[model samples]
Target: MGVSGGSPTSRFECTRRLSAADSQCIWNAIAEIGARVGDRFTSNVPLFNCFGDHKMAVRGLVSARPWVADDGQEGGGGDGGIMMVAGYPSLREAVIAVAKKELREDRVSREQALQLMKEWLQKSQDIKNGRLDDAFILRFLRVKKFSVPLAQQTILKYLHFRNIYSHYCRQLDYLEPPVYELLKSGYLFALPQRDKLGRRVIFANAGKLDPYKYHNTDMAKAHLVTYETLLEDEDNQVLGFNHVTDLKGVCAAQMTLWSPSELGAIIKLGEQAVPMRHKEIHFLNVPPAFRMVYDFCKTLFSEKMRNRFYLHSSLEELHQSVDPKILPKEYGGTIPMSEMIDMWMKEVSRKRDALLSLDRMESQKVMHSYKPRTTTPKASNGITSLPGSFRRLEVD
Candidate 1:
């Protein structure tokens, strides 16, 4: 049954008489609120919800038993002691008592109480590590006895923080323009796997007939447009200018001034653009006037993206114009598409052959190691030497 602790009197306990369905509805309402704001504290805080009374209640409820029968009693000595034991104070009860006392005394603020709860959660974790006593009921009782007001404050503080944090996060999401753009474009998808431990890798199925199939051509065009639009919306003139620049001094060294919306847009766009299906697109394809803007867009990528996208010749050419070493020797010192593909295929085949050989060797080893119980011992008795214990046993 649902119980309301905050309000005085039994009349406020709506769940007390609720049916299963009604109880579920009430719980769902609470959970819905929790889902939105729960991440703020929980995402970074490790021990946020560990030492709660809910856990103790769950443990007690799951393992409770009726009193055992006396040596010569009828019907297990009248009501099985269930009512008495159930009525008796538990750890949770003691904690509640202490929390109440503190509340009456005004010994702690609601925020302090919440901090205590967080501390208690850490204590619970310590218990798991054998650093503290694991007596759940006893611990609860002790906490209740010593800090009733604090406990109450903690509960209130938690609820307060949850509500506040949730609202704030929602507001942040609302203010983020890129998020709106993403939602509008319906381009949201799972981010790609990271490459070379630092670079991001996006996977796409671009078989022959698709209009955007060429990784270097069509996909690049789409990314260029997307990057430009994202930059324009931010009103970030520096980044905007960089998006079109080719020179490192113009694109990388010069700082672009952008508003908060522009900065947020840049961050979000960088994160979002990393997972797009193509990597070979180049910013140089855009006119020289827009090269700074394109470079600014390129700069937003993580190291992985830089590595992958830098592989494109248009990108390399732009880089080489600024610095010759920027493009690797593979693709005319920049690898051709056919040569790159061939190199990738050879690497794949080499690895595949190695794996097959390793597997075959492992299989042969397993077969060789197999022995029948009927076979003679390979080793002589204690007086003789053998290569292994099994060989010695076999010889004997």
Candidate 2:
């Protein structure tokens, strides 16, 4: 078990801070949950999570809706699920295989990789003591398709970005006026339930945003903060995530905030730096008035990015792809949208100090030493060799 590093007060953080024995207990609990999920290693492993007073309802993989639970509800969901389907290998086997592959590619065992990264990461002396974990290392590897050198490079760049970015690398004070304004505007939500296919959903309720007060820059930072928190879930690293953005009230009035430079910067961050792999983006309720804005924004998107853009005219159409059960309460689901909003606010509040700490770390000089390879590396994703149906994954 590893201490979670991205968000403040994350259960991953809480569990990570636990003494070795307690952290082992959490792993024991995980094994127990996996056992109860089904017969052997193929069963679904569920890890229930809590955010402040909220109990995130989760299944298949670890995903939490940052909100207080509905009245009287305990913090868990049914585990009669399966992680391995059809004729695939067990979950444990999958992880082992990936680890082996990474070792073979990098010419180092898991322990060696961890030690190497620690040496590089500790050079800045700005990170928390013993914050690096196997899962953290695995994410970098997974994102870079198991290329050790590439993953190492991404790790450095991520730290470098935080060191330089004004709002990130610990300089982010959630209590700041800009942060407060972003929270009050309600630009994002991580739904309480995974989609029918088990992918986590991130809802960008652009309609709920007050265009005059909503800064696109803040929106991008909000995404980083959210990813930092949610990516703490180890299983989510494998299960992946999808996004649904509603551009309902977007108009020329709001377009004033859409700076091309700001959009491009975020696009690069999402594609090259962020560790999570997104499944898709469903842009529902896109207003006709927002067409000009979308057109300009589309230019920043590449063929890969544009291909995932889904524009649905109505809620029914959107639900065709996304299960309504995991959608916001206003969108015909059991989830409480207000609670999700409240959770996001609390998350921001808790992470402010840690974020600010990273902001001041200044890794510009350190990055030069660990710069990633110019030669891109992408390994075989789980199903490339398999037959038939597939899940469409994208970087949001």
Candidate 3:
């Protein structure tokens, strides 16, 4: 029973502190719930008494409720659910390292920068339900180059994106059945190795997408889980990442599956919402048919992003920009695609609690109060521009 942290509101507590048990069963039970070294380990080990609607079990902690609702209520039943607390000392070290890096690059210490940001953010009506933790605020500060006003606006845009697209963005649980299936299916994942520039490589196979089996919302949630997990690494935050999607064998059915608005949503998320440095997006083995969709989507990209966008006819061409050593064997690298996917899955499992805790960010109050832009003007090329403000907004 090597358990420690919990939510302030959680009523469960032991009258006496439980010592770490030197039992293999205890370790195995903890691992089943994807617990990290510092995560609170609570299980039915026959030694600790169960309290607060949770009955003691013989085997291990179970996830009775997979989804945490908008109002912070756990859905489903069984023993009131085993709560997985999220924290690790190494993660704190990583955050410190990132803050130092920002200081080195921008000559502004994180302490000074965040102090200024905190004053403004405290008064700002944006991010009503989100945590403004040091690490979280540092993410925006680093990306915006310590410009408090810019960082604040970016945070607002991110929240607005989530509110406007709550249907797709809400309750993005990695362990959720559909998202988990997509994660294990290798539809999208971060490569085990980084590119030559030290950027993370996000690989996707369009051929693997089963439109009939999974909805657009499921795909959105899966992508969110994968990207959010990748961004947790401080190195990824600084160096950013490359996106490579293999369009080989993609049929008309799969291409047509994403409606124009859905396509706009994807573009908006990558370009405006996420506070990540997206270095490049390479479309490998792209067929002639995809050109139509590509051209249409290009309308949504900012000029800077349009410059970062690339199209590759073969692995040879892709290798010119990205290192071959970072790619999977199918793309002429040493490791197999399955192995890369397995590595990503293990990383996801390790961060399971943190990923699940993202449920708290889904604020119904924000969504209900959000007002979408009614006028979405179309370009002369006949492409309907995405609604609402983005990075390209004309700021006074």
Candidate 4:
């Protein structure tokens, strides 16, 4: 998963002043949590995330209420005192736009494209190892371009369905048939019925149930008669036979059938190994956010630069160096400070070592177990067979 975001931690300092020790404690807590979560899902998948303007939003640093610009412009407030314009789109839209732009440029060769996808798969292996640097990501955004493919669009549709399934219907059991029918043929099945209150009610008959009930209705009246009449006069037929003989064995006096165990043995031996190299890549990319947090902490403690100067300068530099191509309005990172911090902390806690150990245990249960093949033989075609003699191989 290719994650792109701000410097893993808020750029804004806490409003309530903290002593050096307090600051260090908070930083340590953040680091620990980040490390834990990053390790947990590092081998899972790539999550190509892009940062938004509100990257500096952290609890005790920003307000819960949406920030309003001093200029009275709505939706323009952000961390580091940056004010957005009214026309700016949300972060999701921005990321989508960037992805589209990347697709449009067509910079990557077919081979390179495959390689890049492989890298994403590899990055899903471990969070800490898989984490990307902000500068590196910025460079990648500058050079690499992409478009949201049809597969991603399909995924988005599924995600949207999952999000709003409750609002549109009682449960998913009733929704899939109609949705699939609509997607496939543009026409939907409708059951013409009436409620007790005399209100006309229409339910999807996408299950193809009770075709006769729809025969006289307006929906079926147009073509049902023609179809039924045509089917009745159809040339469909069936053949009957008492027994069958195998022509291939006609010359042979006897034949031997393969055992189920033998077939299973052959299949098992022919199976290819599951691709695990990609898991390594995933492991490498997983902990990028935590690494960012760690690096940010290190920057705060640099001996060459005063901590105060480093903090102010780093924030200002990032603010001024925003690339127009990868702008927040085109990608992500616009989460409010408080919400961002809350989400990070929650993710950290949710993916702790204890939870991950349980996950690992569960995964082991579903993994296929390999059993060695035995040389045992069984009777075939009601004939007991010898190990290797020609007399043992017989056909009826």
Q: Compared with the true structure, what per-residue lDDT tens digits does model 3 show for residues 219-241? A: 77888888777665544676577
lDDT tens per residue, model 1, 262-375: 334435443432212223333333334434445555666566556545322375565552232212233223423333223222222222322222111111111112111232
Please give each candidate's TM-score.
Answer: 0.18, 0.62, 0.65, 0.17
- The weakest ten consecutive residues by lDDT in model 2 span 71-80
Which scores greater on TM-score, model 3 or model 4?
Answer: 3
Query: How many residue pairs in model 2 have overlapping backbones?
Result: 9
Q: Which candidate has the top score in TM-score?
A: 3
lDDT, residue 106, candidate 3: 41
TM-score ranking of the models: 3, 2, 1, 4
**Model 1 regions more than 4 Å off:** 1-188, 191-287, 295-311, 314-396
Would you give me the overall lDDT of model 2?
A: 0.53
How does candidate 4 score on lDDT?
0.25
Q: In model 3, what are the clashing residue pairs, if there are any?
A: 3-41
Residue-wise lDDT of candidate 4 within 125-234, one digit each (tens)?
Answer: 32123223222222222222322243222222322322222122122121134332231221221111111111111111122322222211222221121111111210
Expressed as tens digits, the lDDT of each residue in 137-200 for candidate 2 is 7777666666668877777667656544544434355566665666556677566455554455
| Top-scoring candidate (lDDT) | 3
Candidate 2 segments exceeding 4 Å error:
1-112, 119-131, 168-170, 214-216, 343-357, 366-396
